[model samples]
Target chain A: MIAKPLALSLLLGALAVVPAAAQVKIGVVTSSSGPIALVGIPQKNSVALLPKSAGGQSIEYIALDDASDPTATVTAFKKLISEEKVDAIIGPSGTPNAMGVINFAAESGTPMLAPVGSAAIILPMTEPKKWVFKTTQNDGLVADKLIEHMVKTGIKTVGFIGTADPYGDNWLKVFTEGATAKGIKVVTAERFQRQDTSLTAQGLKVTASRPDAVLIAAPGSSSVLPETTLFDQGYRGKIYQTHGAALPDFLKLGGKKVEGTILAASLMLVLDDIPDTNVSKKLAVDYVAAYEKAYGTKPATFGANVYDAGLMLQSVIPVALKTAKPGTPEFRAALRTALEGVKELAGTQGVYNLSPEDHSGFDQRGLELITVSGGQWKLLK
Target chain B: MNMQIVMLLGQDGVTNGAVYALLALSIMLVFSVTRILLIPQGEFVAFAALTMAAMQSGRAVQLGWLVFALAVVATLMDAAKVWRSKGREPWPHGTLGLLAVAALALVLTKVLPLDRIGMFAQALLTIALVVPLGPLLYRVFFQAIAAAHSLVLLIVSIAVHVALVGTGLLMFGPEGGKTEPFSDAFFEIGPAMIASQTLWVIAATLALMGGLWVFFGKTLYGRALQATAVNRLGAELVGISPDLAGRASFTLAAAIGVLSGILIAPITTIYYDSGFIISLKGFVGAIIGGLTSFPVAALGALFIGQAEAFSTFWASSYKEVIVFTLLLPVLVWRSLAHTRVEDEE
Candidate 1:
């Protein structure tokens, strides 16, 4: 009788010592509302679905809505760290907003994982934060993909219309570099402030050059009409738009004009449509299915990245608790070490190979070229 | 050399020029009487149209447009009464009254929960709020202010803009704007390939311009406003209060802005700060017309709009590069020429 009671007590003690059986806290900040509300809504949905997708340890989500603003993102990050006391933080959606948090995230030794932001600020900064990791492909990959597709499609001469912000600046640089590298000629490139009403000058100049295709980089709904005017004016050249332009809101704004517009998007968009039987694929599918069942609309790239981002952080906390003592820099570093060592772990999006040099962790091949056929995304051949 | 290419450029210019003329007239009429460059004229245009569209933003509002138009006119009338009542009313006399009306309506317009922003909703909201507003405001706020010199009113116009933007920020919340195309009720016009809404804009703007030309050149009331703008005190000494003509001018200017708002609303998207941009472009157009010539201002708006399309069609970035390039050099040359004439005067 004494032996039986002692064995039961020992079993309970062993369970308490095991790290997998323990709960972990992680903070997430993303745009859940505002003009870019459509983008943030998806990320928020995907984040909630990640733990259920993982059959093992349950993750406690501390989601803070940044309202898609940079200032809000900064404040939320501080709140999440001090008030929420989250172990690690994930996401600050837009490139501009994400850039605002880089210095603070590194200084506080709070390891941050950027899900979908893509500007030049996170990496190659004067003070590169080794603690920071990004999972979303940036302008370079998008531009390179466009150029490759253009070259293959025999689009020698191309024109561009872009928004006038840091986002547009990155687009111009990457697009030009990619086109030049691929031996494609640039006909003309024009920049406009976000508020400008007409794209006529830029449109006319580029159309006159006889470009085989036109590339647009504007971030908002302003460029849609000028884009449509391209067809109405009888410029039969193909149009290749960036992933930044791949917004459902654009279709609503642009109407029939967005019907034929081509865009580069993440592999996650076509994830549900594709055939996959593996555990990771099954997990992602089941997660997406459950998420959609709970919330009507299918999970978008924003949600998918954050969901994977949560999973990535979830995997890291166990190693952080295992090899070292809690509340120490050594423990945080080892956790960071474990994250960098992440390889062959099939994520919701794809196999994430997070390394020191590669923060996006995926290459150009990870993306797919899709077009709006009859107002729905169709795989482009 | 290419016929299709030529047609495209031509069509683009024509459509752009029409919209610009309406905007120019709206600003020019106000400027002539008030001698105040109301830079936020475009915002008025956008707001009225946006409000109207937002009110009837579902499937095509077969009879909604007429109802919206009436509502706009009534709101304008109320605004006129409020402006006329200022100084005689309970509130301390100033722009505070017009600011209150504009502020209240401005917020109400932006916060509407429409699934898809219909054609011209932004423009409509701007116009509806501003049209009746100008007369009311002229009586309450601008009567004494305009009695000052033309240049002073110009500077004060900056205050007007500050109030509009600040109120807009407070009420609507900061978000960019968007609108659904009028493709649902769209029927192509031979070569134009425009929506029924766009065609409606073309027709109404043309009719309004034709009517305006007749009224200004023929009507007695129109002549009185013109006299007031030329020499305010002299006009009052003759018989007209100059203040009364100022009221008429205010009404006409607001009406002009509203009409343009209606036409332009169907074509483009509207944002909270869209007024500032519209004001700048319209100013450039007015400058092209010497800022005193309605016909010239109207033409300038059209020219600039066409030039934007032309540049965007041919340009690499498809932005407004050509308009600025053309505007800067011409403005410099015109400025020098005008200085020489002023020196002689």
Candidate 2:
């Protein structure tokens, strides 16, 4: 009986060792099919454009559709970790969806590189998010840029109209914090659902406050309702949108109404128009050429963020691969360490300088205040 | 808030309510005529709005092509049934009408310079492409299952809703589209200003309601639909085709939904998934009317619109909660006042 048990243990050990040279797998969870697919489709496309091989090992990217739901994201993350045994995970684009899997990522000791722009994803560097990293610039940084512009323009009071979800909540919190820090009084704050077709009531309240400026924090084209309502209501106050308005669809949807509105956006959005020596210029130009060449359209900022994540992963994987082979508990740990050690890597969105204390290795340098002028994005002077 | 603010909010509420009333009226019509809830009503709205967006961009819309293809399949089905059951000419008159409409839409899509055409004409073309989808969908998906139990039909409607949503996503892509307003004019009424689009929505809703009244009371076909709704077996005994009535109800529902989409798309961005939430709100209004009376449903939807407008001012985060919770008291009152009756097959 002892001899038979020893032979079974040896057989199991040999089986585990046989696939030591297997391809490195990266798990990706994106909202590829739901309402948030506005951002997720581009994210998936960017990941596909990444190099098929990394660190001399063939890479197998397993992409899952999360439908922009937190539960779906968690399930996809679990499947990636337990079933596929991926070396690292790439994304789940929306803030809430990305938030759903950070704790699981930490507990599993697997590295997660989220391409979403919410600071809370890696804020305070909590224990549960020790293994989590994000490639996108923090919302707080963009909020600061917005505040700086407001102060420079001598706008003292601002009103807020935000969505009712996590994206809205995150922006409201950060923008409020940033505004308060700069002594700008937020006169009134209003909320509406993303699917809401009417914002007359909210717009009325915001206009009633008579603030110097109104900040609309809703994401994507949904921002049009509140903005258009305010415009129709004859509110002449300066209007500002969040970085979420960086999409060209916003311009198309907003038409003339969004013209003259200001927002802090990733420099990648106006890469070609920016000064030649800008930090993000070179990387943004390269990304635009590669992406537009492949997909026949310029990638939105959401896709640029994901491309930054891909570059960050490429920069760190070679270092991780030097220590441990792929598809092992030890390899995942090394990858996490390697991701944390990624420093001064220029990306399409920013120069990533990942440290133990800051998983999102980006700062205010990556953002620029851009306005819609003459039906196109022009960097605000 | 001052009276001016109240008046402004009220104008906005009325505009939004008008659109909701249209959706609610259609939902009530379909439910009364056919027991199955029309879950995919919102999908029609989104599809219609997006089709208009495509036309505005001068791209030939695939919606016309889809309608043509669907009409072909529905005609084939109708012909097969007529051939086997009636032993007559297999050509369906209804199919002929649908095919003509489809052919007209396709021809216009090809020949018309959409950019050169006015916005009103583009909107008309969009509605034309969209309205026929209602009967065609009813014929293809629900006609055969018309006699199924309400629960089974409900399940099938939900499945159809999911399929349409997926199809919408594929056809429209992930981006949201908004069309230019039918009218960009604005006028002041007292201290409040009203957009011409709001006036357009109100005018369209009232006109549609009046038309529906005339159709139900004045037209023989409309009376047939009403009779079928009142007593399916009795109407059948009187030679009113229950199948035709069912198809008519669905077509009206689809038309109403698409009209609402056209009216509201300029006011708010219309995404593929937006229709579900907007239509669900309409369903809520329909429920408040006990899903029976058209006038009451319209009133309920207007009340919902006003309530939403007011609630956003008071507590924006909980506005949806406040609107939905209004159902509880209305439902309790309904239960207390009305006697329960079992549904008849």
Candidate 3:
């Protein structure tokens, strides 16, 4: 009796230690706290809301919350794959995080897609890691639109407030080069970390220089944008903040002052008038209703991104399941191949037309200028 | 000095430096009196601004004047009691207390129709609440963790700040409290910006310094504090309780920090990490002054502030690099090394 019980206990322990044997599980990882946590929380909700039954398969999600650390992102992905035995993965979480986790996908041949990774990360990856894909808008496209807006407004001689991270820094670099080429004086370029609370040090410098208007290439963190607070403490100037500032969290936390704050976001979100070609309005109503039903509050842009990421994963799973099998390398490759066919899919933003070269899925036309008018977003024509 | 350089320097660095100096003094006062560094000095700044924004008073709560006066009086009484209990009668206690009161005065001066209280008032209110709030912090976590080593204490204190900040983030949301530009003040000095808010912080810091001089050099308890700092056991023999010294230090530090918060908040903008940054800069100021010399620390702050201004003007993006570079030479010199200031009385 002792031998039988001991053997059974040993067997159970081994099973627990081993990767769960060949059950269809999709791994999802994203940040959940710190400055990015505000955005990350929505991403978590997206993973949680991924349909329980998709394509007649009971898809199980191996979810991990990265908590905004690059180190944590890799570790979380590793846990989902090795321990949870997830057949496929969805993530990159953000640009830096996306860049950080590529090696795992590269080496393990575990097909992965970066839902929110910058285009730079996806563009640079070689054919070997063709499994890697991304869904975030490109900084170059954002920069192009920002430049166009500045040119249209006849606002010359602008300044850029950059962050220390790759996300904001990349956008700032592109905007700076683009704006400078357009004869706009790149007055001042400064940086602060995503976690930094006060932007006064930087704002004071930028405003003192007397830039015509400030173009903020900041991350999507409430703590990082010192522009609104700077305006309150007496720095006055026109602002063209990035999509990072587009979230309602910025407006809600920033309050009244967030009015007239100009930012570019994916098309079809919060537009007063319907766009010529879009689906977010039709889907937005239902998405908002469903989100409210599920989460009690209207979902943020971050939530929408994650929710769409789940949907994207769901779409790819059907095509992949046809060719891929449980515990097979061909299965992961098939999943990767199926994801590449994601063309002209109507996303919350606009039609995401993805190809080998076009990883961001949408271009400048896919975005629109959102002005916070009367405490709500009104997309400018 | 070249006028061009001076103008640029003033424009680039002076306003922020003024605020940094005030925060540094708050940190030094706590160290000078209690031989303890208040880690929550920054949180003090954050809370004051947050409270200022939240309360939007001077009229909302009835008899705003009374609540303001009571808060000031309570501060004075608390500071006074701590001093007297140690038989030192901290004369500067009321002066520092008054600094906190002035912060309240700022909110009052701006208070109009309840809804009309602009964001700067909210900013000032943030500074005010943040200022006194730090003392309450001493009554919390670190009071028990005081016996830990300096690094451990620092880590614990930082952890406390992060936890408090995170809690604030959850409650307030990522959108920071709104602030309006301080109205009714302008001290134009060439290219650099000096508004009522900046001027207020500078005045508060300087006045407190002068008051501190009187407290230390001219008064009985002030002298006792010096004695207590030098030799606590000897102070007791001569007549001073060590416990009083600690409480006085905590109250004085909080009062000073509140003034710093109030003075700085309007110009700097009240955000969750606002106070923490001030504390960091203040520590730098203290270190530059060898942590023992008040006048030296103040001077160090001014020099650092000016340098910061100059660096920003000349090398806007590399301003931090310049300040850190300045610290390197200061650090290398033995004369600038930190000296353990004996806290007696």
Candidate 4:
């Protein structure tokens, strides 16, 4: 009887001890069901494709949905840090949602990988922002490439139409500065809500300005509207779009109207045409293939943003493991340090070379100039 | 802005105004008859537009299944209510009819080559699929609590709207869709060019409003509905069923909502959650009408559309702010104009 009781107690104690030291816990928060669901759904789905085991340690992810509400994102971050004790956290996909959780993640000493568009999350490098890293290319980097193409094409004047949100505000700021530096004039700047039923007024105003080219800055499929409206309004000037319009739906929705539209986005769009030697090309292809196999559709670049976060964690976990054990404050700090030390780490979006001052360390290699030709994304040679 | 710009903006405003006018009428009709705010009226618009887009893209429309599911739940609730009132109830004929309508719609979607069918047939099929949902929703969510306070009803309406938005996301996914235009032709008037789709929207709205006018003025059922809207107890004493009035008004509201959706789908890209803002504008119009006057509501919606368009031209970022601010003056005027206090029964 004594032997049986002792054996049972031993078994219970072993079961409890094994899981605590065996797995690395990571929490994921995504706005999978609200206004920004266009960006959040894919990121939520990509959580399934993240590496299950990294650096010989099994990983467990606790995923939560914030419904695109900023307050909900903060609550989710707090719960993940205090209740689940995750070593790292990924997502809360919208720029606004990601911006809301920086202080919480910093207070908890947890590393956060935000897959949002704005560069403001890491720019100026505050103490709180140092703990946050962005997965997507910065608006300024993409804007520079666009400005280069505009100069090459001898475009003199450009009209700007963007959403009244952070994504558009940041793009406007960066594009205005870059265009002014390059001697290109921005004639008219207009804004619209994502849910607006019509853009005829904005389209008319932009067309009346009579710029050589018009640039539309909005995220997801919402970017297709201003262009289509412009096309319908008899504006035949060249149209330029931001990386936000890089999704396949842009082609499907714009159809024949979007022909000759220029943009700068990730290599994932032209994976078939990109050189095989490119650092991120192979990984992007593999990710696309795996996602298609699992979901029966190609993954959007937004999903790849989350998957790249997984890749970053995969590379840094081993380095952090040498310093401290998982599920502790020291381990999270070590993970943050290891992430900052990441150099020439290729992800689906781009190569990440993080530093103490720059949390979103990406250069020109991160984005490519792309255009729509014959209803498909084509590399602009 | 020049004359050309003014004319162009005015044309855009008129097109959007017609759709908003239809929404305002429906909202007023539903509120007057059912005493419910009908917040999810916008979901009908979104569902119809998305269903039409799905048909055009050759995807199997999932709205039929949603209608069928709502029907089943509603039928079960009705049967339970009947069993409680009278120990044993016979087969539910009313529910059976709704189920058959849902099943037929499902079968038609599967059997018809939706993409190849002409736009008219596709639209008719979408209307058939989406209209029954209004009555089913009325039955499932509102009939039992029909006697609740207006605030309670508004709260329920909000919940239904949120639930439908989530269901819309699950059914349609997150991408916005736009259908092919009815015609690519444009007519130039002076310095402005108006697309044929704009004319179609205006014509359809006029026809719908005319039909409503005739229905209320010339038909006995319409007068009965009017009576119920005016005095529920008096109508009930005269043997008019408030339940039938509620169903009829919801049916009318759904029809208007779907037609509005079909009209606007080609002119703009519409997402699953786009209907709330559109309907909110209609609600603003309804409030302007004091929730009773149809003509005033329709005119109010038109004013909103024009104000919104001009504001977009002047200060695009503050378009919504300008349009919604119009409501404050109207509300103040309405309060001063009507000082008689009425008590809720």
Question: Please, what are the lDDT tens digits per residue for candidate 2 over residues B1-345?
Answer: 998989978887898788888899888888888887999899888988888887786655777776787788788788788878877654545766987898899889888998679888888888788899899888888889888899888898887777677666666777777788877788888877778888999999999999999999999989998888788888999999778888899989989988888888777877877899888878988988888888888999999899988988899999989988988999899888888875657
- Highest TM-score scorer: 4
lDDT digits (tens) for residues A1-381 of candidate 3: 112222422231121121333256777776655556656666666665665655566677766767568898899878877776677777746777877888887676687767663566777758655767766677777777878888888988776777666766677667877888888888778776553434555666676677778887765544335666457446566788777666645665555666677888865357546654456566556666677787676666766766666667677777877876755778777777777788767666556676766555776656787777887778776
Which 10 consecutive residues of model 1 chain B have the lowest summed lDDT?
B59-68
Which candidate, 1 or 4, would have the higher TM-score against the true structure? 4
The alpha-carbon lDDT assigned to residue A121 of candidate 1 equals 54
Number of the predicted model whose DockQ against the real structure is largest: 4
> For model 1, how does the per-residue alpha-carbon lDDT over B1-345 read when each residue is reduced to its tens digit?
255455556665666567677767767777766676776566566555554544544322112222233334434544576689974643323234444555555555546543345445444544546665565545544666666866676666665554544333323223333444455464545543444655666777789888888887799877777776676667778897665666676667667666765555546666555667666777788888876777777778878877766665554353455676778876887888787554210
In DockQ, how does model 3 score against the reference complex? 0.10
Predicted candidate 3 versus true structure: per-residue lDDT over B1-345, tens digit per residue: 356346544643555666667767767776755556666777666655545544542323222332243355445555656776796654433335634554565465455453465665454544444444444344334444444566665576666566666545443433344334456566657644455665665666678888988988999877877887666568879868555565566667766765665555444335555567667767788877777777777777777777766655455457667776788788778453436553332
**Model 3, residue B281: what's the lDDT?**
69
CAPRI quality of model 1:
incorrect
In candidate 4, the residue pairs with backbone N, CA or C atoms under 3 Å apart (3 or more residues apart, or in different chains) clash, namely none
Steric collisions counted per model: 57, 0, 33, 0
lDDT of every model, 2 decimals: 0.63, 0.83, 0.62, 0.89
Cα lDDT of model 4 by residue, B145-196, tens digit: 8889989889988878877887788778889988999999999888878899
How accurate locally is residue A369 in candidate 4, as Cα lDDT from 0 to 100? 90
